[model samples]
Target: MIFSHEFSETSEYSAGTYTTPTDYFRYTLKVFEPGRSVAEPIMTIEEDYAFLMDSQWIAQLPEVREESVSAAPNELIVYFCDMFPFQRSVRDDSTRLLRDEIHNYIHNDLGPGMLEAFRIQSSDWGFIWYGDWTSSRPGADSERLSVALTKNGTWYHGRAPARGHSWISISVEGGVNAYYENLTDGLISAFYHELFHNLQRNMSLELGGNANIDGKEDAWQFFTEGMAVFASSIGMTHVQFSQTTKARAYLAEANKFVAGGGLLDGELNNSYKAMF
Candidate 1:
């Protein structure tokens, strides 16, 4: 629905790595077999068949369905909780997309500048991790995964949330890049955070970000968490923007932005007026 035309799905991982949908479909069809039949199923049967499918397989929903379940085999609904974009531990050394997939998103030509530069060198794997420290929650450890399906959009489907503890519902995430960038309490993981509430745990949880994060607990938390433009921006940091000095610098300039304000406005004109 987000695109004018539907893009094909990315494939599931196979053997040592992931494969695309076209690859898997080609593999499963065996069209080259000598005695294979290739007739398409009748439309009515096809539609009925698709309707009864588990959430994950309901690719495109047809606009119309026949009055009833004419060919359904059973009444049970398939659950796919383990399938959501789930959370997990991501170490620096692991074979994961976070570290490897960054090649897909090229930053500004001059580079992600000092406002919060991501400086991993090309020779150094070009990957950084959205790490986890929940090892003590063995149930929530990385050794296993849980999946489920729920009625969302048009179908019940598999979803994985970014990483966290086991008994806790996963914070849903997907895509090679999105998968690894999630998991932190930081801003870029906002998608992962939402997945945690809606699809994984299905419970509303309290969350803070650029607008609501507190400076007292983490001086950079407010700015890093507060001023970020995108979810991923929350993770950006300036090498020079130390929590200690930066806060004082901000307060020093806030007298003007704060003249009519209680907080550091930092708006260019307002900050200039307050500081000068």
Candidate 2:
């Protein structure tokens, strides 16, 4: 069962003026097993907005807008920009596919282990803020981006829940394609990588009050990003990486590394060299 609530409000941000007030819908999902008295409920909050540009480059462009949709009990909200090439429905389907893979991994493999290690609630609700638009900084191309905002810790732009909550954001502007023939393998990997950032933040909060690593920020980034890449690799395999052209390209690189005896050498490798 699903219960949804819509809310509309006007708010000002440093970026620009909201031509059309920001609005969002909160969906509460309840799942009950047959012949069981207990139910599992998850909440998904979605926010959509349109802004009048203040930047000179896109100032002439019409108001940019975006929306979000939930895949019912999936515990995630997939945000998509209207200006993007892919239609809303297409983006939704791809997001649902990714969400299903993530859900399975989290519940079946990572959930219990994480709960025990972090001592935090094992809820799976999260957000996937996507698109090409610049919602964080003005005049910058924020195409391929991923970030995690810890509640009450720091505000990195965009809407987030109140204190004590955390969320993830992903931008697919650089790699997203309108053609169904071009699969979203890169976007899928990026989504999983960003999702891992959310998981890292949650674990950090359980160990430390804030998500920041204090003096070890750089080292923390190194570890987190490497792990995120590793997680994405695993996720791609689960989603049948061979089916996507982009994934095949990634696998080719991996195979090259293995062929060079890198796998047995215990070498520290990362998805990106700069990550170290």
Q: Estimate each model's TM-score.
A: 0.19, 0.35
**Alpha-carbon RMSD, each predicted model:** 19.5, 21.8
Model 1 C-alpha lDDT versus the unseen true structure: 0.26
Per-residue alpha-carbon lDDT of model 1 for 138-180, expressed as tens digits?
A: 3422221222322122223223333222222323233222323
> Could you give candidate 2's per-residue lDDT for residues 82-114 as a string of tens digits?
222222124455433342244343334323332
For model 1, state the Cα shift of residue 137 in Å: 5.0
**How much is 7 displaced in model 1, in angstroms?**
43
By TM-score, how accurate is candidate 1? Answer: 0.19
lDDT against the true structure, per candidate, is 0.26, 0.36
Worst 10 residues of 2 by lDDT: 55-64
Alpha-carbon runs more than 4 Å astray in model 2: 1-75, 87-167, 176-183, 213-217, 238-276
